[model samples]
Target: MKFFLTKSYKLFWVLIPLVFMYGLFNKEHSLMVNIHATYFVINHLDFAGLIVIFFGLFGLAYWLMDIFNKKLISWMTAYHVFISIFGLLILLVFYDEVENLEIDYAFKQTLILLMLITAGVTVAVQLLFPINLIVSFLRKKKH
Candidate 1:
């Protein structure tokens, strides 16, 4: 339980606002147009809201993992990765709608790039870190 409330869990608290700002100011239509191609409405606030909620859920998962054992942490990490990837994909599909909503193109691009970079880093960390930790633990156990 104590682990669930650690600094790492709190770090995600900051991301909630970032997701909102990114969705609010970033153009989505240009990105979504290529994917949807027709009749997609841009809902900036709604998308931002969803991102916030997802982040909250992830935070809770982290908390639960922290309260449990190493096996639980590994499972939670996998769950977080899965959910985050799915959310990113959904956002990508509708990104062009943000442009249609009158957000500045440059700002939109910057936000998209930031989101992509963050997602990439997260995926990399999630995939490598846990496996490495588990392997290290196993080796230590053997010795």
Candidate 2:
């Protein structure tokens, strides 16, 4: 249990798979979506969501490459960059649809809360995983 919680655990590699599965199994009534119709609506940002899933798959491939070639990690940064770029592009293309979204006040609040919590968890996981990698590298050098 402690090992799983620490920055040194290989379990950190689970991030990519989790991201992939989250995207693949994304649901209409998912806890992640406060508005059930958000993705189903015409001109909605479904393609952007698909891009995010592809980025996750790429991240997993990047990790596998890193296992064989350590330099790949230094060359390829976070996979979220791809997702962020495509997400912004999609938002730009669907600006009117997004702006005209009719989510209720309570649903909007819930969405905001969920977004905050997810952001916090993502940050913590990112921080912890890097610490694990750094500590491992330093220990190797010291030895």
Question: Which candidate ranks first by lDDT, i.e. highest?
Answer: 1
Please list the C-alpha lDDT of all candidates, in the order they appear: 0.53, 0.41
What would the per-residue lDDT of candidate 1 be over residues 38-119, giving only the tens digit for each residue?
6545465665676688677666655554454323334445444544645464554444544444677798877666555655
Which window of ten consecutive residues has the lowest lDDT sum in model 2? 3-12
Predicted structure 2: clash tally: 0
Q: Candidate 2 — which pairs collide?
A: none
Model 1 earns a TM-score of 0.42
